[model samples]
Each structure stands twice: as C-alpha cells, then as structure tokens.
Target: MPTRTLAGRGRRFAAALLLLAALAVFAHPRIEAAGDALARIDKAALAKLTLDEVEGLRSVLELRASWLVAGPLATLERLARAGIPVEVIDRDPAARWFEVTIGPEPKGDSRRPPLADARGREVPQLAPVPLEQGVWITAAVDQAAGPSTMPGSRVIRVSAAGGPALAVAAQRVIQRVPAARAEVRDDPRIAALAAEVSPDRLRTSVEALQSFQTRDATTTGALSAANFLYDYFRGLGLATRYEDFTFPGTIDGVRVTGLPATNIVVTIPGSVSPDQVVVVGAHYDSFGREQTRVFAPGADDNGSGTAALMEIARLLARGPFDFSVRIVAFGAEEYGLHGSRAHATAARAAGERILAVLNLDMIGYTDRVPEDLDVVVDTASEWLGSRYIAVADKYAPLPIARRLDPLLRASDHAPFWDNGYHAMLGIEDAVLNNPYYHRATDRVETLNFDFAAGVVRATLAVAADLAQPSRAPAPPVGPSARTGFLRSLLSRVKLTELAWSPPSDRAAVGYHVYRSPTPHGTYQRVTGSPVTATSFTDRVTSAADQVAYYVVTAVDGAGRESNYSVEVDDGTIRR
Candidate 1:
C-alpha cells in the first residue's frame, strides 16, 4: 500500500509540472529589455531625490524610460513625498501603461455625489489623481489592452498615433508632473528635446551683397548668381545639374539665333518613390535699360524671388523627402518665359509626371498693398490651387486671401498648365502696389523677411504634402516565361553591379545581353557566348538599332545565368 501511494504521488507531481509549463506558454508574457533596465534602477534612490536633483542627474544616467513617459511620474512622486502640495496622477486600468503627473492639490468644499451606488452613499473623492504640475508622461502599450486602472479617474486607451484620447491622457499626465525650477543657463540635459522645446537652427546661411547689381543676360551677374546657386546646392549635398536651351529671338529688332539660356537645376532624390517630382522655379534673367546698359539689378523683379528659391533649395537639401524636388532658376523670364517654356515642352515630350509647380516672382517689398494682397489662385483650375491655399490657411498663423486674378497670365505656370499639369503662381500684387516695382530701390532692405517666411512656410507645407510617399502600385502578374526570365536577369545583374568592387570582379563565365522592342515586349539574347565583360558597349551605328532597350545577365561557373541587371532603354539614357 505504501509503494502504490508513493507511485501515485510521483505521477501527480509530474502532472503539476506539465500544467505549469502549459500555462507559461499560454501567457506569452514579454517583459521588454527596457523593463529589465527599469527593474535594475534604484527606485529607492529616485524616490529620495528632489525634483531639481532628479532633473540634474538625468543627463548622466542611462535611464530606459522616455522623458515624455517617465519624467512626470518621477517628479510627481518626488514632490508628493517631499510634502509639497501635489496631486498624484491616476492610471487607467483599461490602458496598457500608466502615466503620472504632479501638480497642486485641488481646493474647494466637498459636494455629495449626485448618483449613488448600491449603498446609497456619497461618492468619496471620486476625482482621478490630478498631476497638476507641468511635467507630462507617456507610456506606450499594445493596442489590444483596453484602458488601464486608476481609481477615481477617467479610463482611456491611448494610441501611439496621438489620437484625441492619447492627447487628453498626456495632458493629464503633464499636469501632474512638477515644473522644473528655472535655471540661469541652458540645460544640456534637455538639449535633445524636439524642435518644440529647442528650435533648430536655420539650415541656410545668409550673406548680404551690398550694392549688388547685375548687367544684361550675358553679364557677370547672371553667371555669378548661377555659380552661387550651384555651389550652395552642392554644399547642402544635393545632386545638381544644368540644362542649356537655345531659342531664336528678335531683341530690339535684331534677330538672334541660338540665344543661350541656361537653367541651374538641383534635384533632391526621394527615398521610396523617386518617380514623382515637385518643382519650384524662378527666373534668373532681367530687362530694362540703365547707364548705357540694361542695368537689371532685377533684385525685386526676380533677384528676391531667386534668392528665396535658393534658400528653399538649401533647406530641402538638408532634409529627406518622399518624392523628388527639383529647384530650377530659369533664365529669360523678362523675355516672355522662354526658358520655362522650353523646359516645360521638353518635359512634356519625355512624359515627365510633374505633380506641382510653385512659381515665385517679385516677392520682395514691405509695402502693405502687394505684401498683404490675397494669394491669387489660377482661375482656370481653382480646385487645384485652392486646395493648397486651404491647407496653408489651416496651418498658417495669418489669414490667406484666396482671390482669382485676371491679369496674372502668360507666366511660368501657363507653360506647366499647357502640359496638363497642376500649377500655381505666387507673386506680390503687381498693380500699382509697390512704388519700387522693378526699380533699383527694390533691394534686399526693401524685402520683408516676415512676408517671405510666410510665403515659404506655405510653400513648404504644400510641397511636403504633395511629396509624401504613396502606396506603390501593384505590378501586373502572370507574364510570359521569357518576360519573367528577363526581369529576374535584370534584378540579379543590377544587384551584382551594386555589390561589385573596384579592380573588376568579373570572372570568365561571361554575360549575355538581351534587347526588347518595348517595356512589355519579348526579349532576344544578343550573344551566345558568356560575355566576360562587366559592361557591354553596343557600337551600333544605325539609329534604328540604337533605340532598343538592353539588359545584362551574368553567368556562373556551372553555366547558370544570373538575373538581368537594371532595365535601360538606350534611347532614354540621360547621359
């Protein structure tokens, strides 16, 4: 009987161990690395420190909690224990985590609860712990958790996307956190805070060129401006390029052929969607005769606009965008939009998808008439321009005038519109508004930086919205076997090129080049031998043969052909 009982006890113990293992798997609890770090921290020491002492020590400690999440809670608890009048922030049971705030204790006479519980007794101090201090705490949690637990406080599930509930919770948490004592010097501890707390420096440098004036289109002024723009863009780490367009024109009754018109274009490539483009442009040329020459200081006429465009380019180059932003300072706007017209025509012919165009012209002059005039929208397509205006108005501090103008035509926006694109023009009101209109007095001093900043801010908002990345369109499936083979070959070859090193890593396994008539056409291998070359240069003299698309495939030792390199149409190659 004793032996049987011992065997049964052993079996029961084994079953209990198995049940514990099953429960462990079912719980699937994950204490984050951060939680482990928090566990190691000396909570007792933290509890003993004063608000100022804790903030001062924050810089040296490698705390795992976010300031937005932990600072308020710590401050509230510390102040409360120190006998400072403070409120303790409550936690929502349905929430994944609790936020704590410190603030002054609430005052006023107690009132009986209007709604009684089962006992018909007055609710006692039903208010959630009020963290009335300015500090805020934010705790992130899994979306599945409902609201967290906190007695006498409203329960809310906070989302990471900064939803209304989250914002309210954050506000409550901040109110509980104790306000830091004012310091004489800037605290290095909080230097890493966001721009809201510590604003970022202006990325673009400002240089004043006193008595700066330029001669005619071919003068040093035009070239210096172009060089300055190019260097500025390059300094900001942007990929810069220039396009030269020649046009026949009759200047002062003198027929001129092949008049050189150059445009300095800087491209900020997108990270995800590089195909879409947003262009900001201004004219670099000037007209009007002065001092035995056409002294087109053009400062207000276009220099101001040009300068603003350059500054915008500088800012964009310092940051990343989801879509390409091309800043083009066009030449010869005074000569009837010749440079812009040429660019627009070429882009249309090449099937360029231009999302928007922001044209800046004569944006200087502090006079209230032009500087304060309503931002004009295109009468032809008010919907496109009006939408941008509305967004700007929503975010901008000042009111934006959305009026249609009849006199604003034949500008750079027209050429863009002609190509079936959405375009808008931003210009100071030109109708007897500025007394210094196109005069030498329209210098840098005459320009209102506040107004320029407003315009720039509006432009940035619109451009940023348009340039945001969209879901990539799904590619078609079930293509022919040959097409799939070509695509695979291209992908492999491209990856190899990207991964290849200097001194040529190509072995004698050779490569095979294929050609296709169209993007969706069948591809035929051009050569049978494994082309052992890293690059295949087709020296075909016939223009017809040169117009085909080419892709390269590498072969391995076992005669296995790798996927094709990046697709390229010889005719569409830029360089």
Candidate 2:
C-alpha cells in the first residue's frame, strides 16, 4: 500500500509540473485560455499533490502572468495547498465568502444591480470605501458569484474563517475569522479615562445629530450638525475652528459637487510634544436614496461615529497630554472623503508630525451575541491596528476583528492613509449588517448605545495612550546632564547621564526621560515605558558631534505624567 501511494504521488507531481510548463509558454495568451486551463484542473488529482507541487504550479502561473495569480490562480492555489476536496464545499449551502474591488472606475455600462451583504440584504451601490476613483464591489459568493469581471485586479484572502474562496464576484475576497486581539496591559489611569465614556451621553449626542433629519454635506442639515459640534467643543473650554471645503463628485447619480461644507476641528494641547499630533475623527455627513436631500438621518451610518468622536473630545478635554490630540468631525465624507482629503492634503503639505489617527464610523448596530468591532487597516497602518486591539483588550475587552486591506478605504480614515499618516478605521465587522444603512429609517432608535460606548471606550484608551495623560505630579526640577565614557575590552562608548530632583508631590511614582536636539524642539521619550529611577543613562549616538537637550517628568501610580522639567543641556554646549 505504501509503495502504491508513493507511485500515485509521483504521477501527480509530474503532471502538475508538466501543466505548469505548458502554461509558461502562453506569455499572455487569450485570458480565457488560461482561465479555462485553471478551471479544467482535476480537483482530485490536485488535492492528492503535496504543497510543494502545488506551489510549483502557482509559481509558474505567477511568473507567466502575475495578474492571474491575484485572480483565479490565487483561489486555485489556496485550494490545492489546503488539501480540501473541492466537491465537499461545492455541495454545502451554508458556505459563503465576501469580496470587495479597489481600482480605477470601470468605463461604460459597468453598472450592475446591488449585491447582497452578509445578512442577504441588497447593499447600495455607493463606493463602499474612500478612494480616488475606485469602485466598490462587496458581495457574497454563490452560483451567481465568480471571479471579478473587471480586466485588471488583485485578490487578497481576508482570512480563514469561511472555507475556501467560493465563486467570488469582486476584485478581492476576504473570509471572516475570529479577530486577533493583543494581550491586555491594564493601566488604571487609562481604565479610569475609558470608564467615563457614558452611554447616555453618547445617545444624547447621537439623538441631537440625528434630529437634523439630513446631513448630506451639501444640505443645511450638515452645516447645522457642524455648528452643533463646534459649540459642544467650545463649551468644553477647548480650542475649536471651522474648516470649509468643497467636493466635486456625484453619489447615486446625484450631483454632489460645487457646494461648500464645514468640518469642525478641536485641539487639545500637549504639555510635552505639542507637535506630535493624534487625530480622532468621524464623518458628520449622511446620504440616502431619493429624497436624501431632506430625509437622510444617518444615525448609525455616521451619527454614531460622530457622537463617539464628540464624546471622546469631551472626555479628553480635561487632559494635558504628552502629545497633542486633534478631534475632527469631518464633512462631505459620503461624497468621497472630501473633508478628510482636504485636511490630510493640507497636513501633508505643511509637514505635520501626526502620530496616528483613530477614525470612528458606523459603530452602533450588531445583531450577534457578542458585539464585535472591526479595525480596518492597510499594510502601512497595521501597527496602529495592533495598538488599538491591544488597548481594546485591556480597556474595552470586546471581540475585535482586524482587517488588513488597502481596498477597504471607504471612510474618512482612507484620506489620512492616502496622505501617508498612520490611521485605522474602527467599524462593524459584518458587512451590510445594518439593514437600515443609508435609508431614512437609519435613526437613533435602531442603534445600540451600549455597543457604541464600548467602541468609543476603546478609541478613548488608544488616543489617551498615544497622547500620554498629564494629570500627575509636578515636573521634576534641577535637571542636569553629563557626558561620560565607558571603556570595554573591544571599544569605548559615549553615554549621557541625566538626573533630576524629585517633585514636591508625594504621589509621584516614577520618572520619564526625554531628549531633543534643540531646547524648544520636539522632545522624544527615551524610555521604552515609564522608568522608576531618578537617573537615566542614554547611549550617545547622535551626540557624538553636537549637543543635545534633556528633560524629566514625574509619573504617578495611576500612570498620569506631569509636564516637562527645566531644560538642561550637556556642558559640551553653553546654554
């Protein structure tokens, strides 16, 4: 039996290599030919082959035509490598998959009927995410679904939740799986801050925003929502401003352009590094089908997100953080992320050091047992996503699904990502789960405020962590720095020793060391985390040829930090 099994495996390996060799000669034959060859592969034989043989076939297809790799070949490769029988999934009715496309808008007669979301509701044909001009094709796979009909595209598997990729209809297919969350690092200070996220207050804000009837960016309701937010932030004794922008585009064939919109911006100053900014934003605009100009009540679509943004702004107002926090309620997001695009463009041009952006969108509806949140990120923003999940694990403790895809750019966070800032979008994981999305029926009545509060608490914790809380003891004083040499058997190294007098406050627990090239320049935290020592020794690398500035701050038991101490410099340069 073993000898026969080896013979059978040897035959399958030889056949797969021969098929790959034949495919390499195509050099861009009719795409249908390649598609037909892939479609005609013997599933039984393919499944019997080892992963190495399957990879050989996949490598040849990728080399001959990389486009095929992202399309049918990707699905085929996944199946052959997983060692699952194609017939098993083919007969299962409960098996389904989801996909979305991101690329140039297809030209001419490309419009198709709206696709069904996870719950089998027909989702609208709006561009699901923010993009320059990419089309959104979100749907479930079945007899009607197959590979993307578009010419040029790439398919990235979302995860291993659903079985193999069913016949999908979009540019990319993502299977939902349990979200990967980071280990909890409980900090009492941040926990206290997150605990203050009031569900009632969140509902109040959502109710107010929804009462406007419509906030279609170009309508009077949008301006009203913006004004309401401006006043709310102003009442918090925070700095607030209005940024007007214009969007040129159309949604659902409505001319949504040439009209002015308002974006409300609030600033929470950082006591330490004011230039290092963290943005927490949500779109205030809403969209509906016909009569949308007057009756689009985007309570869950964005009123939920906007309210969360407002609540966080209110919560963080009492903070004097290590880094600045900028809360923005963006305008005209439904029409193509116009408000965030304008803001991101301006921030990029001005050379702002934005540390991260946490965008809240559609956080109020969930029909599942455990209400979960989805953190959407591209390759560049995965770190931000990880940090968010870590904070959620400790502060919010809800199930979270982390989705990494550049094509999921249908919200305000997309603009910041486009402008090269680290940003992540916190949204509901299930696509089209809200049956009332984009309809006049999308009211606060259909929202779950408790769920919204949980999402906001996670955002608050992340934002607060990035902008270190500054409500601790007074700053350490009498800071002094000295340069020394540590000689080793192999080499001599330069070190900068910094020391400071303890603050008068008895509640102080530890100290944080910061360094800067100039006295008033941005000071970077030198310690990985808070240090309990009064003196810190930093290995001197940049200081080899020039002077450096150092300062110290005190931290309390709750993890709240104080302002910077008096600036001190190495005696190498006169101050």
* Backbone clashes under 3 angstroms, per model: 40, 5
TM-score of each: 0.45, 0.58
Error of 1 at 315 (Å): 1.8
Q: Which candidate gets the maximum TM-score versus the true structure?
A: 2
Task: In angstroms, give how far residue 415 of model 2 lies from its true place.
Answer: 1.1
Overlapping backbone residue pairs in candidate 2 total 5
Candidate 2 to native Cα RMSD, angstroms: 15.1
Alpha-carbon RMSD, each predicted model? 27.6, 15.1
Residues 179-206, model 1: lDDT tens digits: 1211111222111111111001111211
The lDDT for every candidate, in the order shown, is 0.45, 0.65
